[model samples]
Target chain A: MSAGVRLEGLRKSYGAVEVIRGVDLDIEPQEFVVFVGPSGCGKSTLLRMIAGLEEITGGDLYIGERRMNDTDASRRGIAMVFQSYALYPHMTVRENMGFALKYAGVKKPEIKAQVDEAARILGLDQLMDRRPKDLSGGQRQRVAIGRAIVRHPEVFLFDEPLSNLDAELRVQMRIEIARLHSELKSTIVYVTHDQVEAMTLADKIVVLRDGRIEQVGTPLDLYDDPDNLFVAGFIGSPKMNFLPAELSGGALTLVEHGGQTVPLPPLGRAPQEGERVTLGIRPEHFRKEGSAALEVDVEIVENLGGETYVYARQAGSDVLTIATGGARGLRQGDRMTARFDPSDALLFNREGLRIR
Target chain B: MSDVAAHRLDPEAAEPSARAALRGPDGPGRDMIGPAVKYIVLSLAAFVSVFPFFWMLVGTTNSSYDIVRGKAWFGDQLLVNLGNLIEQVDLPRVLFNSFYIAIISTVATLLVSSLAGYAFEIFRHKWRERIFAALLLMLSIPFAALMVPLFVMMASAGLINTYSAIILPTIANIFIIFYFRQATKAFPHELRDAAKIDGLKEWQIFLRVYMPVMRSTYAAATIIVFTLTWNNYLWPLIVLQTNDMKTMVLTISSLNSAYTPDFGVIMVATVITTLPTLIIFFLLQRLFVQGMLGSVK
Candidate 1:
């Protein structure tokens, strides 16, 4: 059975340096929540704290209503799959899968039965006799997951589990992990720096920055409506293009892009006139017909068969990425007018706070 | 293109001449000189290393007078030398003493030092590195400098003449501990994490996970500690007051110091003393190579 996890004012520190600063989160039972962040953002640290691998410095951590700050990692009803696969090189796949069960004093036959069931789930029945070194990287990862599954943990924690796999294998394993969560109906807290993995697999994506949760929402919420400049820039692949702007009389003028004025996006609250703000625009939001347009010098054009990305720059401005739907016959040094809807742009204040 | 230009450009056309040039006097044959010199040097080194064993073997089969005359070939004195050495040395009791001390010392040293090494590498604290640095600094202090104090301690404990004096000094071997610490660095920390999550406690992880994973390292340590203990002469000579308690190396030293030393018997004793280390090296040679390279791989 799955159990929910809750962290109340979680704080982790090393001497005077605090890495996790007052993180409070609730993970619903059987929900797949992903902690997504850049490097050194305390995502992995928080996950480790939840799993009881790391000592909770100042926090109340609850796994299914029980305070687990003092509980040992093994007794916390959590299983973790490390990025390195961390399979014991000396143990066979079967032994590795059944290790926790054996240590928990389960009978030999029961251990075998559980291992077999996990193997069947992961399609690892053929490779049970082999050691970790003898198997492929993907196979070794499957064994690691199988090892976690045999214990029937209420919560499964994955710390960048697919970071070590090759690209194709990473996609395959990502799907497999999502399937496993559904089949077992268990709560899972997965950590990854790759926003694509977070977006594809997470029921709720917790965007973290500088050891603090920046925003928490569904994939589209984070993509379409990021809470801040950091989340706006982080979530999407070919990340959201940010342009400097200044509010001027119910419209925003691109400061570096020839003072082109566009109508202000509709918002609950608007910034004061003449205030400097950052404009966030997703690459895919650019369209051939829109109310706003910027004439730019095309620096690079990348054709990916089905779509084309035009990296263009305005005078004294950062290069903007525009995803043209298909091959546009655009070339480097070509002058193009990139167009987008004014309502699609997101505005952030000087402190990087979203204005709306 | 012109035919001559095309010919110059064609790798197929240039192939035969290139092959012929490689097979010519200044090409492939010239490379042979490097290998030839290497073999000559290696053979000289091999002969230099093996000649002492050959001479010792020849001395074992020769009389004292013949050995003194530099006899480099076999003779009929093998059984006589064996008989004389056996008669002089209480073979079974001396073997027991050497084996007992060496085995006990090796096992104890491996257990103690490896545990120390694992702990030194695994645990984290403010003092961990400073204490380890002090231990490393202790490695540079010569054994000769510490021997007098160690002897005094043993003498005060009434252990000077006991086997403890010989075994106790080496149990917490700094060099082996350093070796184990370096090897343990290659030990994946994630395994310990996994074992902890597998419900194994710290000590159980050391035994069930660390020990088996690091067997090659243990085998390598066993060979090293066993050889050092077996061939240990100076320390054993200083502490072992009784002839029965002396190791084989001490016995050999005593034979060498005799007023009228029997060369044949000395050679036989030397061979006997060397056999155990050789046997150990042979048994653990593959694992020793693996351990030295990095046991984790």
Candidate 2:
């Protein structure tokens, strides 16, 4: 049976500086939730608190319907896979998988069966007798996951489980984890700083910054409708670009780009005419030709076979990245015209909060 | 005709004269001389370090008078030295006492220290860290300063002349604790968390998970603690007041102090005292080195 998790105003602090500042979230049963943030943003801390590995400074954690704030990690029916794939170095893969089950009051036969089933799922049947040192990094990671799987936990917690892997192995393991989630249909909470992993594996992504939640939504929801500048900048690769602008007469005019302006749809209320704003645009949203255009000096062009990214400057401000299809003939110091639809732009206030 | 032209045009065919021109004169002998001197120096150091053990073996086969005269080879006095060693001490009992203490102390030290080390590393509480730092400070306090108080404590507990008196005081040793703590820094905390989620309580996790995972560390600690406890002369001499309870080191000390002290017999006793530790080290040498590397990493 599976269970949902509810963290109500969960907070963690060490020596007065709060690492997790009052996080509240309701994770539905069998949903894969990812806590994505930069290092030290307390995403791992929040996951640990839910796993009962870290003590909650304040607020309540409920697994299913039971309050788990004071529950021991084992009693909470949770299993965790760590970034280092902390398999027992001395034990065989089979023993490593069955070690916890031995203490969980499972019969020897049952334990062996469970371990065998987990090994089969992780494709580690041939490596059952091998110690961790004898296995490669991917196999060792599989053993670690198998150790967790044999427990049949109601909730699974993963603390940056694929960070130690190389790029190719990380992608492979990421797919394996997605498949495992679907197969087990268990509620999972995964933490990582890599937004690609977060976007790909998560049923719901919780974007975090400075120990606070920036936004929580589906991956596409976050990409399309970020609630803050941090979320917009963090969720996408190549990151969303921000340019200084001013709101005037239902029009957002780029202040730093030689006064290039775009008319905005009429809002019931408007900020002061000269109020400063941030114009956010994803690199892929930049069009080669459109009704609105901004002339920029191309400083660098990276041709990645299928797509080309142009790093350019408009009116001598921060560099803006524009991703275009196919190989481009753009070169350094070449003047280029970049265009986009007005609807593609995201508007944020001076304080980095989304304005609309 | 074309093949004949290609063979004539070949580089090897054309380079016979150039080969002699490219052969330069021999280089200087400086490089060979450096390694030659280094080998001589290293062999000399090895000789100096190993000479005493060789001398002891030779002395065991010589008469006491001949040994005193610095005789350096085997003689017909081996039987006589063995006889004297047996007469002067209960050799078997003394050897047994040394072994029993070392084995028990090593096992107990590994268990207690590894437990404490794992606890300190896995559990991140304020007081535990403070206690750990305090333990390190305690390690720096010389054992000589605590010996008298420790002796008094043992005497009050009615543990005088008993193996427990010697073993108990050194069981919670700070050095072993510190060694385990350092070794434990390399232990993946993820393993502990995994064990916890696997439904293992603290002690179960320690015994089943931590102990098995840290085998190399335990092996190194066993050698170190065994060597230290087996060669423990002062504490054993002070605590073991009875002749029957005397360890090998204490017996050797007493044998050297006797009137007309038998050098041959003393050599035998020295060999007996040193053999157990050497055996332990030889047995666990690989694990010991591996453990050391793991800790430093």
Interface RMSD of 1: 0.7
Clashing pairs in 1: none
Per-residue lDDT of model 2, residues A258-320, tens digit only = 787876533335667889988888999889666668889998899999989999997667899
DockQ for the candidates, in order: 0.80, 0.67
Candidate 1 per-residue lDDT over residues B40-64, each given as its tens digit: 9999999999999999989999999
The parts of candidate 1 lying over 4 Å away from their true place are B1-32
Model 2 complex DockQ against the native: 0.67
Mark the 10 consecutive residues where model 2 chain A has the least summed lDDT: A263-272
Worst 10 residues of 1 chain A by lDDT: A50-59
lDDT for each residue of candidate 2 in B168-208, tens digit (9 for 90 to 100): 97788777888888888887777777777777778877887
lDDT of 2 at B187: 79
Clash count per candidate: 0, 0
lDDT of 1 by residue, A218-282 (tens): 99999998889899989899999988999898899999898989888888998898999998889
